[model samples]
Target: MIPIRDTAPCYSRPLATWGLIVVCVIIFVWLQFLPFEVSNPLIARFGMVPLRYSDPSWAEHVGLPFDGYLSFLTSLFLHGNWFHLIINMWFLWIFGDNIEDRMGHLSFLAFYLLCGLIATALQWYFDPRLEIPVVGASGPIAGVLAAYFFLYPLERVVLWVPPIVVHVPAIAFLGLWVIIQLYEATTSILFEGGVAKMAWWAHLGGFIAGFLLYRLFLKKPPDGIKMEDSSSFKI
Candidate 1:
């Protein structure tokens, strides 16, 4: 299902979220301008590579700079193509504003990076031996989705289910997402040699990290912002 929008309202503009999307877009545009020879090397150097750490010899082959640690952050801004960039940025656009409203701007940005780091770490943990470089904002965006899932469990979301648009409870929509991630993650580990085309574990990890970190990072809403429930949320 593709979410069109959410019913929950946001009083403050999500500046950080917008900035992130802009940065990602600019980077993608620059990437588009680069020839394949340079673009391929850029992705190799910046995208997270588990093999850089797990098998030290891998670095000799790809030459991951800054010892490959900074790739965790750089990878968040890189995307392989227009479709990959659009899907990730679209997700951030949908869920990020409400999450930004809930946590204040700077805090939300930190929360985003932390979740991305955690997502990268988890992907490495699950596929340490795999050599592919994982790239995208899906990790941080997953964090935003998890925060929204908790912040407005009952809020309705409009989604496209092929031929129809459906309004579903936030809980149902996000719950189904987590379920799909879990199923995909498990099956990937079991049958795909622990490496899927997309970083499924990173998506799952980002959600889990967001679930655990949102409360820690949460702050008072802006003067005009009002929270739903402000008391109870369901699973």
Candidate 2:
């Protein structure tokens, strides 16, 4: 199912969310200008390699001495293709504004990076020997979805079911989304090459991190609704 928009209302403008979208777009555009084929050594330099701690030759040539840790954050801004970049950024634009409003600017930014890092770590943990580069904002955006689920369970999300349509609660939609990820994750473990490209574990890890960390960073409504009780407020 594709999400069109959410019905939740925000009291504050999401400037930070727009800024993040712009940054991601610019980085993706820059990456497009570079050679992206697997044969190109440049891919290894900018991409996140799960097992290796050493810096790629391109990074060293460019005067970046750090290993893939920095790439964990940087890789989020890169994409393998137009479809990859569009889908990831689309979700980010859809859900990020509400999350930014709830967590404020700086806090949301830190939370986003932290979620991405944890998501990368989770993927690394599962596929330590895999050398394929994982890139995209889906993992961090999954984190935002988790926080949104927790903060606004009753909020309505308009979903486009191909040619059909349905309105579902954000909690239900995101819940099913996570379930799909879990199914893929488990199937991938049970059947070799069940899913070739997706990082299901990263989504799981980001969701868990967001669900937990949201408690500490979530802003209380100006009306003094308890965080736990704020779900009762409907749009």
Candidate 3:
């Protein structure tokens, strides 16, 4: 299902959400302007490479500090293409504001980064030997979806059920999404050596992290306040 929007009105502006989107846009623009291969070599030097923590050749060659911890954060800002960047940012835009409203700006930012780090750690744990550079905000955005599902499960969401467009409860859409991720992860494991490059495990990892972390970080709304339906507007 393609979720168009939620019905709830955000209590706060979600400054951090906008800020993150802006930062992602700027990074995406910068990446587009540069030669694709110019950063290809650098990605190997700086991007997280699962398990094998070998010395970075580019770091040594360029006399730069190649810290793994730093890469955990930097990888979120990098993407493979315009589509990758747009979809990630779009997810953040749609679901992030409500999450930010619940956690507040600063706390939401911390929660986001924390989830991203944990998601990366999980991915690395699963495939430490792989040398492919992991990049994108999908992991963290998946966390946001997890948190959203818990905080407002009943909120109505407008979605297109391929060939049929309709509205459904947020929980229903997100729940199905999680199931799909689990199925993909299982298939990836069972059907070894597939050409599919999507990181289903990362989504699973981030979803789990978001589910657990929301309990700790989400703030209960004030009494008498009600969340709105997310699919009130027609696209």
Candidate 4:
């Protein structure tokens, strides 16, 4: 199901969320413009390769240097195609603002990166010797969705189906998503033989991480520094 939006009301301007979207868009545009041969190299250099950690010699054979944990974060900003970039940015745009609003700016930024790091690490753990580079924001976006599920259990998510739009309870929508990821992870493990495919483990890991970490970071408005009562400090 394609998510059109949510009905949740976020009172503050989610500047950090907006900033992330802009930065990701700018990077995607730059990547799109690079010469085709160079673009692949650029993606490889920056995208996370699980073997870079498990077997640096194998990673070197694939033209990747010993990245020393940097790709865990860098991979979040790289995308394989326009569809990959757009879909990820779209989900981030939809679900990220409320998360940023509740956490304030810097806290949300750190939360995002930490979630991404854990997501990549978990993917690496499942297939330590894989040489293919994984790139995209889906893992961290899954993290954001997890936070939303925890914080806004009753919020309505609007799903678009051609000319029809329907509202599903946030709990139901996110619950279903996580279930699908788990099923996919299971199938990938059981059926893929020795090949790693979608990084379903990353999605599961990020969601699980967000589930665990959000309570630590979400703004306790009653005692925390109060955010301004504004529509959106949108940039």
Q: In order, what lDDT does every prediction score?
A: 0.88, 0.78, 0.78, 0.84
Candidate 3 lDDT, tens digit per residue, 1-235? Answer: 6667887568889899999999988976876677868767666555676543444564455444557467777877778888888888878988999999888888898888888888877777766656677888878888999999877787877886889879787888899999998988788778878643766777888889999997677666579975343333322
Q: How good is model 4 by TM-score?
A: 0.91
Clashing pairs in 4: 13-232, 13-233
The C-alpha stretches of model 3 lying farther than 4 A from their native spots are 54-66, 162-164, 220-235
What TM-score does prediction 1 earn? 0.92
- In the range 1-235, model 2's lDDT, one tens digit per residue, is 8989888777788887788788878877776676656324555666677655443554466544556387787777667778887888888888888888878988898888888889878887887666667777877888898899888888889999989888998889989999999988778788986655788888888888888787677766678554553477674
Candidate 1 lDDT, tens digit per residue, 53-112? 787766776676446398989999999789999999998998899888878899999999
- Cα-based TM-score, every candidate: 0.92, 0.87, 0.85, 0.91
Off by over 4 Å in 2: 35-40, 54-68, 193-195, 220-229
Better of 3 and 4 by TM-score: 4
Candidate 1 Cα misplacement greater than 4 A, ranges: 65-68, 192-195, 221-235
Residue-pair clashes per candidate: 0, 0, 4, 2
- Winner on TM-score between 1 and 3 is 1
Which structure is stronger by TM-score: 2 or 4?
4
Identify the candidate with maximal TM-score: 1
What shift in Å separates residue 27 of candidate 1 from its native position after superposition? 0.4
Q: Please report how far candidate 3 places residue 145 from its true position, in Å.
A: 0.7
Error of 2 at 132 (Å): 1.6
